[model samples]
Target: MQIREATAADWPAIWPFFHRIVAAGETFTFPTGLGEEEGRDWWLLAEPDRTVVAVDGAGTVLGTAKMNRNHMGNAAHIASASYMVDPTHTGQGVGRSLCEYSLEWARGAGYRAMQFNAVVATNSNAVRLYESLGFEVVGTLPEGFHHPVHGYVGLHVMYRLL
Candidate 1:
């Protein structure tokens, strides 16, 4: 697989899995009824914020990630990122590759650290992946996320020093 910066045209391929993941209400905090234009606006960040896609040899998009400052001004040194992998492509290292690429980008961009503010507690795969990648759970908000099936679940704040 190859990882590259995403273009506006990439949205057509990204939206399908992005829509499914968001609508599932399992991991991401995105609202269920997010529209196409809104999703594009949210995912296809501009300028210093970066968005990238992981594609197979045939050029099929397998996953995507967006990285940016966790906060503005004085807090800008801290970076944050989000990832989405095609459900059909899970376990094929798509998510891992995107995450690794994002970390490299963040470090190269001079970020002091990276933080994930709202990782769903029940998403063990993601939690494990983050831990394996050197992130630690700094805190958890009890019953912070309302999972569709599991009801209220914790949201973990994870951090890693660059």
Candidate 2:
């Protein structure tokens, strides 16, 4: 697979899986039933912020990630990112590749650290992947996320120094 910066045209390809993941309410905190345009605006970030897609040899988008400053001004040295993989493409290392790429990008961009503010604890695969990549759980908000089937569950704040 190859990783590359995403273009506006890529949003159409990304939206199906993004919509599915967010609507499932299993991992992300995004509101279910998010509209297409709004979702596009949220994911296709601009300028110094970066968004990328992982694609197969055929150029089919397999997953995506967006990285940006965790806060503005004085806190800009810190970075944050989000990832989404096509459910059909899970277990294929697409998410791992996207995450590794994001980390490289952040370090190259001079970020001091990367933080994930709202990782759902029950998403063990992602939590494990992040941990394996050097991220640590800095804190957890008890019953912070309302999983569709699991009721309220903890949300982890994960961090890694670049």
Candidate 3:
């Protein structure tokens, strides 16, 4: 899969996977019923924030990610990112590449570290991916996320110094 910065025109391809992921209400905190326009606005980002996609040679979007400052001025040195891989394309390393690219992007942007604020603990695949990428579970907020099928689940705050 090839990773590249996403252009506005790519939104259409991204929407299908994005919509499914958000609607599942299993990992992301986005409103379970978030609509198209709002989803576009939230993911497209602006300025210092960046968005990217992983595509196959045929130009199919296999996954996507967005990166930005973890917080405002006081916490700007730390970076934050979110990722989504097409369910049909899961286990093909698309999400891994996105995470790797996001880290490199943050480093190049002079970020001191990267922090994932609310990783649903039940998402073992994601937790393992972050750990493999050098992130540590610094803390877990008890019952922080309401998983659609898993009831209340802990949310991990994973972090790593760049």
- For candidate 1, lDDT tens digit of each residue in 63-146? 999999998899999999999999999999998999999999999999999999999999999999999999999999999999
Each candidate structure's TM-score, on Cα atoms with residue i matched to residue i, is 0.99, 0.98, 0.98
lDDT of each: 0.96, 0.96, 0.95
lDDT of 3 by residue, 54-147 (tens): 9999999999999999987888899999999999999999989999999999999999999999999999999999999999999999999999
The worst-scoring run of ten residues by lDDT in candidate 1 lies at 67-76
TM-score of 3: 0.98
Q: Per-residue lDDT of 34-149 in model 2, one digit per residue for the tens?
A: 99999999999997999999999999999999999998899999999999999999999999999999999999999999999999999999999999999999999999999989
Candidate 1's displacement at residue 157, Å, is 0.3
